[model samples]
Target: MDLETVMQELEALGKERMKKMYISNGAHEPLFGVATGAMKPFSKIIKKNQPLADELYATGNYDAMYFAGVIADPMAMTEEDFERWMDGAYFYMLSDYVVAVTLAETDIAQAVADKWIASGEELKMSAGWSCYCWLLGSRKDSEFSASKLSNMLDQVANTIHHSPERTKSAMNNFIYTVGISYLPLHEKAFETAKAVGPVEMKREKKKSSILLASENIQKELDRGRLGFKRKYVRC
Candidate 1:
């Protein structure tokens, strides 16, 4: 689909309630506030249009940018394209869930994620951590190094508490990702989660509790979903 048509459709799909919710969650203006459920059918329609996704993201409209992430082919995207996407990715849903998840599917996932996590930029670092976390969910144990994973987990255990606001939240997610997705590291992740305890995040002037990594891991365990890898990081 063309950018104009997608924008028009997003406009038609948007709702005041959704817009208010996005605003409350720290999204900037120029948003259509089309719900994810509402966007799914539309996103599926454009899922293979790489050029169109690029145009949509460049528009800088919140809904369009999100749709861009939903449809873009990471394998076809250049590193420069990802950098440009990160530059405009302000909201967590856009940065972490959409951009990060899409990037995780690329051949450059590790290199990009490592660089991003180490970046001084808050959004970039958060996106990087999230990218790595989702990568764990998407890949099998045989595809990566156990020692390297352990070292990264150790690093998070030591530094997550002192990390930047969004990075801390992402780090917390990393622990949960490790706990549930990597069976051998489950004990280590549980220990790290216990060490970190509950994560505190400020949302709309209130302290919101991000689930403890151990608790989330246990929930997965109880549901018999531990060690079950996702087919893809997106969605």
Candidate 2:
């Protein structure tokens, strides 16, 4: 559970073996490093070794270490350290898990979300979803400033709009995370999706998100009228 052991294990799981059989031959730059997606399924085991995870995060591979941070409080990150960590920083692998943990039925989850949401970096915007999702699940009458939520949605929608089909799928998945878990933000999600337009030349699934956002909008509005919840849905 200490830092040394976790480093040893991650070192053993080098980039190649971690690739399994997937390869990218045609691109100008083929896959080179370990991806966050590859490390996610091991969350439970990762939690058991918290100190090690923090140590790894302090290294150049801080991205993956972000998973452990959200999952088990990424080591002993000082406030000053996290501020630097937020600069050009990302923990892409555990996007969904971060969303889930922030929204989870827990005691200190709001505190955890507050820490992550402190990072206003473009790359770290999904922490907005983590906070938004947490509010939806835990606070029935949650009211929040619409500006930041809309900012996150706008940035993410644009990113998904231009990404490759596969990447678009990942972005859309996160968009839906915003939808399903953040009722107060449902209209923003729906409007964002409506603005996304049909997928252009590169990635066709861009518009696929509208299907989801539209669903969430209707579902929440209908249930909301029945007193399931109430909040301002920004136009």
Candidate 3:
């Protein structure tokens, strides 16, 4: 479907309650607040459409931007394109979920994510770490370097306490992802999670969230989910 038709369909699916929820999570105007599950039919029809994705993303509408990621052809995108998408990602929902999830589908995911992790920007770092989480959960353990992931666990153990709130959240998730998804570094990740302990993520006008990777890992381990890998990164 074309951008206009897609946007119209998305608007028709919008819900007032979801719109308020998105606004609460940092979304602004021009969004339809279409639930993510509601977009699957559109994705099924459109499959992969780079030009339409670009158009939808450029609209700066939250629902449209999210749907863009659903239909985007990551292979057709370059580092520059990813950067551009990252630029437009105004919140964690867009950054960590949309941009990072889409990036995980590409061969260049790691290289680009590495740059963003070092960028030291709040959402960028969040997306970078989040990209790794997605990658580990979906790809084979062999796709990652054990040494590199070990070093990253060390990095989280060292810097997570001082990171920006969103970055801290992603870093915590990274430790848990490594613990459960990357088999080669599971023990090290568990150690890192223990060392990192609980992270307090301060939210704007909201209660702070206490993130404990160690506890999360243990819960998953109790469920016999260690070394778990998802079949897909995105819906």
Query: Which candidate should be chosen as best, given TM-score against the real structure?
Result: 3
The lDDT of each candidate is 0.85, 0.46, 0.94
Ranking by lDDT: 3, 1, 2
lDDT of 2 at 61: 48
* lDDT by residue (tens digit), candidate 3, 1-235: 6788988899999999999999999899989889999899868988999999999999999999999899999999999999999999999999999999999999999999999999999999999999999999999877888888888888899999999999999999999999998888888889888888889999998999999999999999999999888888888
Query: How does each model score on TM-score?
Result: 0.95, 0.46, 0.99
**lDDT of each residue in 82-139, candidate 2, tens digit only:** 4444442333333324333323334444454455544443234444344445455445
Off by over 4 Å in 1: none
lDDT of 3 at 89: 99
**What would you estimate as the lDDT of candidate 2?**
0.46
Winner on TM-score (2 vs 3): 3
Task: Tell me how many clashing residue pairs each candidate has.
Answer: 0, 2, 0
On the 0 to 100 scale, the lDDT of residue 168 in model 2 is: 47
Model 3 CA deviation exceeding 4 Å by range: none
Error of 2 at 145 (Å): 5.5
